[model samples]
Target: MNEKTVAGYCIRCNDQGYLTDLEQWNREIGLEIAEEENITMTDKHWEVIEYLQNQCKQGVAITIRKVGKSGVVDIKQFYQLFPNGPLKKASKIAGIPKPVSCI
Candidate 1:
């Protein structure tokens, strides 16, 4: 019999950190949340993150209004389309640093 080895993504670096990687300071629970629920990470996700990061660099929240500039829907729609919160799983896959708020 073989046991299943679960692999998870790190919330901080988005690297595949497994059970041996679990630590207290900056580890995110719900391993499945990090492992599954990853979108295809299309240009759309990139566009969204780029806009959000730019706005964040300016000390502003990336709102639907800003997302509108990309012709994308609100965060709610993003979640609906992506099936997970913006900064939790998808953002990690999209290659954006985990938002401080999400930590």
Candidate 2:
């Protein structure tokens, strides 16, 4: 298993840069990822991030349309939150792999 550091802790990540071990995730790590993405974490952002993480854990496909139906936020709002590519960036911040539909 490949290892990467986050919040000063060595953790595992997949080839595409998503955290391989969800157990290694934490708010500080998420904040660092959000910062790297040039996004400031807000309550709304946390809600969306957590939602996406949950979706990932459930093995559900994630997309703008799917998130819109989640009632957490509509597609437009998702864009406003994550700016340059909502699903992709948000998933990254959530420590979930880039969804298959992302690319």
Candidate 3:
């Protein structure tokens, strides 16, 4: 697969532009991705992002309902935090792939 560049970093991205090389993720890349998504990273947004990153590291599968149940934030708040396609966008911004339950 072809890799792309963002913020001067080589990135392997999917059709929707999520990182395929999880190890290549960094704060700079996350910020660039978030900017591309039109999201301003706030504390609440960080909460969910951190949660997803931690879960991903633990090999946990994330979902809207699972995030809601995780107590980091509820489903409505998750959508509010990442509007539109919350799980997909959040996972992408967190430098993880789209969740299986997402599509």
Candidate 4:
């Protein structure tokens, strides 16, 4: 496994930069990851991130369509929030494995 420092913490991660250990994640790490992805965290973004983390904890398969129906954000807004590769970016920031639905 690869390791990188984020928010002054060394975190294990995959080659794609998604954290390998969910337990090693925290708000500061998420913020750093989002910044690396060129995203500025907002309340709505935090809401969506929480939703994704909950879904991941429950072992639910996450997809764009599912997130659209999550009532957190619609598909268009999801794109607006994460731009290119929303699901992948969101999953990374959420400290979960990259969704298989993303390429």
Candidate 5:
């Protein structure tokens, strides 16, 4: 486990930088992570992030196809929102563990 300060809070994270403790996450931390990922948060982006976080809490396996089917955003738009690696980037910003489905 690695500890890093984000949004003035020291949080535990994995080697890949995904937060290890969901309880330690907040919107400010998410914003900082999004900035690090080079993404500017829009309401749409927050919607996706919320969706991802909720799914994670529910123990739902997150996948691009699932997110696409999720009313939040389609696959194309999800890609557009996060660019290079949507699932990985979004999950990171959402303060959830990196999905097993992600490479």
Candidate 6:
């Protein structure tokens, strides 16, 4: 399937057309998104992604949102704080891990 068909969003660039709609989560795309977000190896977002990558490699995978205390919020508040709503791009900047199953 195409990246758009899969992730529902394109990951090629930061623009609209080069962009594909985000469908859902996939490990390959997740890693790509991490790279696109410019997440450094020493950054907090990288820490979370590294943890998640380890877990996934171990067959003990977990979603990103559940790894921290930020999970304790309602939908409205969650989206308000995360306007883009946890895209890997924004998450890396915010120093939070990308949403495990997000597109």
CA RMSD of all predictions: 9.2, 2.0, 2.0, 1.8, 1.6, 9.8
* lDDT (C-alpha, whole model) for all candidates: 0.46, 0.86, 0.86, 0.94, 0.94, 0.40
Q: What tens digits encode model 3's per-residue C-alpha lDDT throughout 1-103?
A: 5588888999888887888878899888888889999999988888888899998889987777789998889898888888998999999888898976435
Which candidate, 4 or 5, has the higher TM-score? 5
Q: For model 3, what is the alpha-carbon lDDT of residue 65? A: 79
Tell me the tens digit of each residue's lDDT in model 5 across 22-85.
9999999999999998999999999999999999999998999999999989999999999998
Quick one: best TM-score, which candidate?
5
Clashing pairs in 5: none
Superposition error at 79 for model 6 (Å): 9.9
| Candidate 6 wrongly placed segments (more than 4 Å) | 3-42, 64-66, 69-103
Candidate 4 backbone overlaps, count: 0
For model 2, residues 1-103, the per-residue Cα lDDT tens digits are 6788878878788866678778789989999888888999899999998898898889888878889999899999999999988888898888887877435
Segments in model 1 whose C-alpha atoms lie over 4 Å from true places: 1-37, 63-70, 90-103
lDDT score, candidate 1, position 22: 21
Q: Cα lDDT for residue 30, model 6?
A: 53
Please give, for residues 1-103, the per-residue lDDT of candidate 6 as tens digits: 2233213534432232222323233445555544554433234444444544454445553443544433344335334333453444444332233345556
Q: After superposition, how far is residue 59 of candidate 4 from its true place, in Å?
A: 0.7
lDDT of 4 at 88: 96
TM-score for each of the candidates: 0.42, 0.89, 0.89, 0.94, 0.95, 0.32
In model 4, the runs with Cα more than 4 Å from the true position are 101-103
